[model samples]
Structures are given as structure tokens and as C-alpha cells.
Target: MLSRTPKMLLQTPGARRGFHSIMSSLVPMVLEQSPRGERVFDIYSRLLKERIVFVHGPVNDDMASLVTAQLLFLESENPDKDVYMYINSPGGIVSSGLAIYDTMQYIQPKVNTLCMGQAASMGSLLLAGGAPGCRSALPNARIMIHQPSGGAQGMASDIAIQAEEIIKLRTRLNGLYASHTGKPLKVIEQAMDRDLFMDPREAQEFGIVDSIIANRKAPQSSGKQ
Candidate 1:
């Protein structure tokens, strides 16, 4: 379902040492389960009811559709509230992540992304789209950024067209990262030329993340979104 039941929401277990780590492991599975079991206190159920969206697997067309729909729904329902997105994907198709990233940018509300596990490749591109100061990752989470690639074969003309398209795609990706991180396009391009694996600390230092999530407590933030 694109929308969650309003009554099905549950509060997240507040900060305990290693709470994020624990949730990081369990949430992806828990959130997938239906409301058959105890639904009231179900963390996953609650997350859906709130403004939380989970990206637990690959970023493909299906994944992209779900996230974009949820973000659009959340923004329409409450334009002032923030949208909390947790990503734990190995990454997938470039255009899939781009759709979600574009949706996040188009929304009036601030979209916050949490790297709970492996946010690599196209996943990092999605993470980079979060509104300023809203991008964060768990202390032990891993993040990566890299150039996009694809293959094509047919006539020589087809191969040439594919090559030109890939080049354009790389340039677009470079511009996206540079705009988000305030880094030079050359710097972002160099980092992406090879797979760049980073922990939360390095990701923050590299401008991929703005904060290291210490806790989940939120007290009605507003304005500067």
C-alpha cells in the first residue's frame, strides 16, 4: 500500500546505547511484516504511520515508486513536518535513485535520510539529496559514492549513443554531488571514479552526511527545515 494506516503507528524505542545498531538489524524485516501480530507497539507499523519511509533493499523502479509515493503522500498530508527516511540498500539502477532524489527535492518539507546500513553507489546519491543538516548516518553505518555505468550493444551507432548518454549521466551525477556537498565537481568526480567506502565519520567529513545520529528524539522542529 502506498499509504499507511494512521492508527497503526508505534513510537520508536528511544536512545539506549546501541539502540540504533539494534534497530538497524531488526527494522528492515520488522517493517515488512503485516499488522497481524501485536500492531500497537510495532515499531515498523509506527514508523509508517509517522513520516518515516524505509529503503531496505535495492533502489530499483519498484523501490523508487514506493519512496516517491510515500514522500508525496506525507508532504500532502502535512507540509510542515519533516520526512524521516532510513536507507539500507546496496544500491541499484541509477535512474531509480534519481527519481527518489528528485522527489525529495521537489517536496516542500525537509527530507531527512538515515544511513542505517550500507548506503552505497546510487544509494549515496539518494542520501546526498536530503535537505541540509537533515542528512545523517548511524555511527557504524557505511556509505559509498561512485560513477554510474551501463552496457549496450547493437550497431556501432547504438554503441556511440550509449557512450554519449553515459557521459552525460556522469556529468549530471557530478553536478548533483557538488551542489549538495559544496565540493568541487572535480573532487566529487575523483572520489566517484573509484568506489569510495566510508564510515559515518568519514562520510560526514566528506560532506556526505551532516550529523552522526546520537538519538531519535525529536521535538517539533520547524522553519529552516
Candidate 2:
């Protein structure tokens, strides 16, 4: 019995070329690993061709750079297609998260952000920042939002400047959340005063997610949602 060829291999010529490029990049890794690496490489290539991006770790400079590049590349490849971003992060540096968020907004393609586990702090902001009506969370996913946190250790004058900057970041982030969720700025600010956590349903109510994904009877046939 012959194994079935991947759908990507059967799609448009463009997809085949994209898949080939993905495989080419993974060749070095495949050469250095066991057979399992091949399997991993295959899955990763499929995901890339499917236009799925993952954010499964902390939001840092490296993650920002890679994700930004992927978003731009996908947009260049097909500006009309929707991009899927699956996020499961505890959140990290504000600057790094902003870089990704800015790119998401800058791209022509609609970004469908799916929360798999927890989207907290800056992570929650990114979740809310997805294209309107495209943000979603799994049934058991949790979401959180809070004011940006930072520490300052220096002379009184320098510490004061740092404190001012932190306040500015908090204000900017609060404004963004309010704009995305259509909530009052004061309401968003109050919610962010502490670590406010919510499940999928609550996140929907809070406007962090437009919907909670339900079980599908069949595999997803399109990237619209």
C-alpha cells in the first residue's frame, strides 16, 4: 500500500514551489538528525504551506524577528490569503511583542489568532489585536490582561525617568486594548490594574476573542476562520 501524497503536493504549482523551498531550508537539520527529524521537518513544511505560524514560547526579540519575517513573506506570496497564528505564550518583553503586533497590523492578509493554551499580558494584547472577528480561543484556553510591569534601579532622577516610561507604556497598551475590545479606556485600565484572568467564554465577553472554537465535524477545509 502506497502512502498518500500530501495535499500541498497536489495543490497549485505555487504551493509546490513553496513546499520545496521549505524543505530545502530544513535539509541541513535533516542531515544532522535521526529519522524523527524528517517527520518533524515534513510536518513543519506542511504547516508553513498551510500558512500557519506558531508562537509557543516567550515573546522575545528572536521570536519577533522570525514571526515578522514569516508574516511579510506570506503576504508577499499571497496577499489575498488569510494567515493563521496559533499562540501559547506567557508573554515577555513589551518591545518584542509590539514588533509582532505591528507586523500583524501592517500585513495585508487577515491574521486569525488562535489561543491554544494561555495568552497572558502582552500575549493577551496580541490575541485581541488580531483582525476583527478572526480572533478565537479553544474551549479550555485561558486569557489574561494586566498593566505592563518593569523595575528601575538607579539614582532617583534616572529611576524617575524609567517610571515615567513605564507609565507611558501602560497607558499606550491600555489604549490599544480599549480600542480593540471597544471598551472604555477607563474600564480597560481598571481591568489591567491587576492580573485579570478569563476562560474562553469570558475572553469572548471581554472582547479579547471574537469566538470560542467549537468541535468541527470535519477537518477545516479553508483558512477563513
Candidate 3:
């Protein structure tokens, strides 16, 4: 077994990348020696390391990397357990959020997402991407989803091309939100034009949030591989 380390507390944006990078680098090195049989799992449970992921600030590349690293580590260290991701982010960087979304979809462990405060824009997308009936929010949490925006500099043609790409992304996202929420793309499209915001109950009705959390409860997985 590798040497046990203290809990990595990622309280600041600056600390996230540093912490998960350590886990990312350490996994391959230690996996061979990591116990697979029924051994004490506290080593992985410290700080709820393998079972929980937090998105508490703006979404960005570092946040994406952190979430990726955490998922990768948990996949390697505890593939059978459930992961609880709590999001309280204001959203940022569309590509970063998409990266995190892809990882959440690709990872082996089932992910249950809870919006503890607010999830807007990309954050709302992330919240809706949770595994099946696993999407939820605090009773007072808020959610917002809107068309993505982008900017480009340089040649006029290049700017027009970038604008077209942004429009494409908006279309893609509208369909994605529709798929998850069971709403039609046109409905989502109109709402994005005005920056739709919803409380927990409204979000559930909108199909973005599956349940409004009234207390702490561990969600049951769908048991699908």
C-alpha cells in the first residue's frame, strides 16, 4: 500500500489543481499495490475522498481538471461506490463545464448531483447531467440556464465563423437541456433568450431538478453499469 496522506482540503481555487494533480499522479503509481479484497476502506473515506466531489465556485479549467482527477481517482480506488457531487457554482467557461460533463458521463461510479445553493448557466447543465433520478437541489436552491455566448477577434470572416459556432453551441445546448428535462428544444430556446431562472420547486417542474431536497439523504443508484 502507498503511504497514507492527510486530507487534501481544497478551499481556495488556487489549491484545487494542486490537490487533484497529486491524486492524478499518485493513482497509477499506487494502483498495483492497492488492496482489492475486502480491506479497511477508511483510507479512501477520509474527507469522503472517494464518495464526494465539490463544485463550490466558478467553473473553469482548473475546476474541470479537479473534477476529472477526483473522478479518475475514485474510479481507480473505489469503482463500486456512489459519488455525491455538490454544486454551488455560478458557472463559467463553457468548455470547462463540458469537460466536467463528459467526465461525469464517462466515469464508472454512479454520480448523484445536488445543488446546495445556485447552479446557473453551465452549472445548471452540470446539475441536470447527474445520473438518472439522481439530480436534486436544496429546497431553497436556484437554477438558471441560457444560451452560451462567445467572442472572437481577428479577421471579419473569422469573427463571423466564431459567431456561427456560438449559435451552433446554443442549438446543441438547447437540445441537450431538452433531452434531460423532457422539454422541446423550442421551449428551451425561448427561455434561454431571457436567462431563465428557477427556484428549486420551479426547477423540478421545469425538468432540470428531479427532486427538491428537504434533508440529507443518500440517493439510491439505478444499478446500471
Candidate 4:
């Protein structure tokens, strides 16, 4: 499991300005190595081989951008291995979600998603992008799906453009559901219209996931041969 150093800062653009100032004011810390003694290592050094990256928080453009970058880095570093994504998001911007989905699909890694909390709206779509043998949620986790939503300003033509974009987003989302559930497109569309929400068991029953992995163990190989 790969571990990364935690860096905390308020995520919103307005809030980040204060964090930037605070960081700039701090003097950097420096530590010197002992040059003459036997070498010593810390826990992080001993645990470098097994790493699990944690990407927890709201789904926004900044988060999406960072996730995409990390996915690219992981793909480059480990081209043949599966990348586990533990998602617990209440969902956010549709476009941001699409950006993440596109990156995940393009990387083509076997993505195993563990939905520990909630995977709703756009988050559900991202979960659906996982590879065929991907794992699913813990017992209490939930997954939800619905039509795309957006806000608009300005003229009537702008509204029309936004509407068209929403339609396209819905079509893309429906396609994902259809592929994952092996359901007809029309049926998936109807389900999306219903604003479907399912717990782990229900989701698994409907073919939304392979199984409910409550123990959080490594996903077993499906042995498709």
C-alpha cells in the first residue's frame, strides 16, 4: 500500500488564498543526517513497498485534476497492475466527474473501487468505470444514479446550450449503466429518471457490482481463463 504525506489546505479558491499566505510566511524545516553513524530508517522507509493512496474529499475541479494526475502517475509506474480507488463522495459537478471518468477510462487500469460510504450521482458514474473484475462496496455503503444537472446564466441560447449538454451527459451516464448492468439502454434511461439508489446488497443483486466486499480484503482473482 502506497502512502502519501498529508497536506491540508482549504479547498475552495477563496479559502486557498489564506492558506497560500500562511504557507509563505512559514520558514521551511531542515533536518541533517548523521554522517558518521550507522544508517537508521523510519517506519515510512520500511513500508515503502505496500502503498494505498487516499483521495478523500469533495468532488470538484481541483480534486478531479489532482486525481487525474495521480492516475496518470500510477499508470506510468505500474502499467500491468490494478489500481484500487476507494471512493466516498456525495458527488459534485458533472463536468468534473466526466473529467475523472475520462481519465480513468483512458488509463485502462483495472480499477477496483471500494465504496465505504456513499457513491452518489456523479460518483456512481465514476465507480461504474471500473474494470470488469472490479470489486464493490462494504455492507453499509450506498450507490446512486440520476440525470445530469447544471446551472446556467445569460441568454436563451445559453440555456439551450446547457440543456443540450445535460442531454449528452445523461446519454453518456446511461451508456455506463447499460454497460455495467448489461441492461438495455432504454431500461437504464428509465432507471436514471427514477433517481435510483441502492445499498450494497441491492446493487449487487441488480448486477451493478460483482459482490459486496465487507471485509475489505484484496479482491480475489476471477480467473477468467
- Listed in order, each prediction's TM-score against the native is 0.77, 0.78, 0.75, 0.73
lDDT of each: 0.75, 0.77, 0.74, 0.65
Candidate 1: lDDT over CA atoms?
A: 0.75
Query: Which candidate comes out best when scored by TM-score?
Result: 2
Which stretch of 10 consecutive residues in model 4 shows the poorest summed lDDT? 5-14
Work out candidate 2's RMSD over C-alphas: 14.2
lDDT of 2: 0.77
Q: How do these models rank on TM-score, best leading?
A: 2, 1, 3, 4
Candidate 1 positional error at 145, Å: 0.8
Identify the runs in model 4 with alpha carbons over 4 angstroms from their true place.
1-51, 217-225
How close to the true structure is residue 3 of candidate 1, measured as C-alpha lDDT? 29
Residue-level error in angstroms, candidate 2, position 30: 10
Show model 3 residue runs off by greater than 4 Å. Answer: 1-45, 217-225
Report RMSD for candidate 3: 10.5
Candidate 4, lDDT over the whole model: 0.65
Clashing pairs for predicted structure model 3, backbone only: none
Scored by Cα lDDT, where does model 3 land? 0.74
Tens-digit per-residue lDDT, 92-161, candidate 1 = 7777778899999999989988888778877787787898988988877988787777766666776787
lDDT of 3 at 70: 85
Worst lDDT window (10 residues) for model 2? 6-15
Query: Which candidate model has the greater TM-score, 1 or 2?
Result: 2
